[model samples]
Target: MYLSTRIDKALFPTAALFFVYFLVMVWVNNSYAYFLHEYMGAAQKNVDFEFVSYLAILAAYCSFLCSSKIRTPGDLVVVLLILVLVPHALVLNGANSFAPEASPFSGVPLAVLLGVSLVGLSNKIHFYERDSGEDGRRYIVLLASINIAVLIFIVLKSLGHFSLDFSGQYIRRALARDVFAAGSPSGYIASIGTQAFFPVLFAWGVYKKSSFYFFLGLLNVLVLWGAFGQKYPFFVLVLIYLLMMYFRRHGQIKTAWLLFFAIGFLLLGVVEHEITDYSYINDYFVRRAFVVPSSLLGVADLFASNNVNNGYSDTLIGVLLGSERSDPLSFQMGVSIFNNPDLNANVNFLAISYLQLKYLGVLFEASFVGGVVVLLNYLYACRGSFLAIPVALLFATKILEQSLPTVMLGSGVSFMLLFLVLIAAPPQRRATGSPQQ
Candidate 1:
């Protein structure tokens, strides 16, 4: 019975639905002007009408076989109604709303409903582990080999012929720009800070243990604050916490002296003068002190525009795609999703999340087709790091961006494709290497 049960695919229908949604989304994108002006825009009469239609359609077509059974049919109906209605209300009324043009609650509400329904279905469809055999070992070896090759290339580049300017002048200019308000100080700091972030992330991946992830996460936050000295650190801190929790679940790490360091660093920033720049260290902090306020202000300005612009536009996405760039916060967010070879910029996970919402309209994308794409991305990519990528994406989306199919496909498609191989590969049984936990 167990074997027979396991033989049935858990998410075949969900997978199919997601592919169809993806195709539809692509079609919609190509013909966006029509749908946006005709159906969605025109449906704005009586604000609640759009939501009502969505609920009615979901009820009419979707089967509730995946949802939980309640004590009575009436209770079941009530649960279903709440699952559908509550998210809609929250989205329309809650902080999630961005543009006045689109119903304020629309995106969030749909996100909640879709999330609930999918979760219910996932619960019904238990994801069991299969014996991957020698193929699994081979996959891990292949992954590790690829990582090693990349690392070797970096090492060779750094040690063999690399002659980077390694200039602190950029930092000085950034500070002057802030002091004079000539350009965005936050942008400079964020740009430099983002340059620093990859090392920290790579450290976490190599460490591959929970404690290392925690330590690296805290380290990244501290460095971000020390270097940038603004609200931008908050995103990195949040991401670190998420990574910490994720690793902790795997028993990869424990809260230890690392957490202590983070707390101490944060405190130092609040009280100690010029702590963020650490100019005292070698004039770096002193220089950053001049730039910190401007950089911080720029980050604040971007958020303030949420009220002014009504919705995020191409500006933010362009930043990610390296077509246009902004101050540090925007640069970091943009760099995270799309790797800019021209700038020698790598992807930053935290930045990717923020841009998703900033450019894509978060709740709307997540609750519907976008959510499934993320799920499939998980199934296909980041095999060894399954929950991490999507969780990071969702986290980024929640605070900074929204999920858009085209955005995901256009910029991140290749990386996502590579990640799928990782997920399909099996875990190592011998567990050859361990971090310094």
Candidate 2:
């Protein structure tokens, strides 16, 4: 059947059910995990709630995807409702059912789920084709130049042309070892280049309307993520900004203003550091700064723990990869990475990684591999929005995660962009005549 007929009968029920489930999960979660230990428990319990929400939202969106010629507004409504409720619900509930930490209860998965939802919703927007414009040759050349420079820097480091040291004293010696052991260069300029490249490329993608630029940005971000580890959110912000610019271009200034206000209020604590003890925002920013250095230091300190010829290096990686939740291992890893001869420092990168991956198995490949797949799937599926900012965002996450443990966080910027895209997407069969709006 047609778009109107199909959505009338099939989509609304699914949307209502999805909303009901989300509300219950957010409002009436009577379990201790949802109430008593909300903020105090490890971050994983909060993540578990998000994983459930994604599954539900994903199913709801899939039904929309199946509808024949789904109307643009219908798609917009479904996606917006999910994006608003799921992540914000988690944020509002916080650690103590309604704990008061900055950016509370919610994290990256929520941001990513919402980002993906926005792109999916945007696919239904009718993009009016432009009269054949100049081919995107100049854009491709510029991006290639940028990628080559970064690649060259990576090669030089691998060959030891310069000592790659970005870990300043903010971290302990042992923790530094873990950072070094991961062994990718943390060079000051290189680090910035890796992080900055995605946004630059994303803006190009939008201006040129080039799919090649889009995928290139996506692939580069993933590779950077794999090389870096855990600090992918910075690059995601770049993508979100690109989308914001797009919305503004499409005459969605009012929508953008509302999003800025909401995110500002939601992440106010994080922005201001109001809640220090067990704060998710603090934990994310502080721990990330230390993780790279601590990991490098942990690698070096492996020798201190035991004699040579006994597989010290392998032991360090094993320690890094194994016994994740073991409290003792956590302490030891920290001391090694931070070079805490006095044993006061707490470098538990691997312990955190392991604890999160314990039930999944030692490989912990889901965060690495499956996360990439989820991001790439979103990018390719919405190819129509090749120049779209949210798509660039989808690419950046996968790209950053490739080298870094760029687990999606409820990024302030991404959430803002989701709101913008949801609002910018045109009503059914409608089209803005010019890029100038």
Assess each prediction's global lDDT (C-alpha) against the native: 0.33, 0.36
Error of 1 at 5 (Å): 14
Q: How do the predictions measure up, each by TM-score? A: 0.34, 0.32
TM-score of 2: 0.32
Candidate 2 stretches greater than 4 Å from native: 1-11, 20-85, 88-92, 97-129, 135-137, 155-227, 231-385, 389-437
Model 2: which ten-residue window has the lowest total lDDT? 403-412
Residues 1-437 of candidate 1 have per-residue lDDT tens digits of 01112222323443333223322322222222112322211111222555445534443223232222221111122233332223222222221112223332233333334444443333232222322333233343343344344333333322322222234435533443343231344333333223233333433443345354345445444433333233344544554455445544553322222233333433343344344533131223311221221122223223434423223344455546555443333444234322332222111222222334532433343344334434443342223443333333333332222223323432233343344445465543433343111
Write one digit per residue (lDDT tens) for candidate 2, span 14-58: 554544444343332232113222232212124366556654665
Stretches off by above 4 angstroms in model 1 are 1-127, 131-214, 226-417, 420-437
Q: What are the per-model C-alpha RMSD values against the true structure?
A: 16.6, 18.7
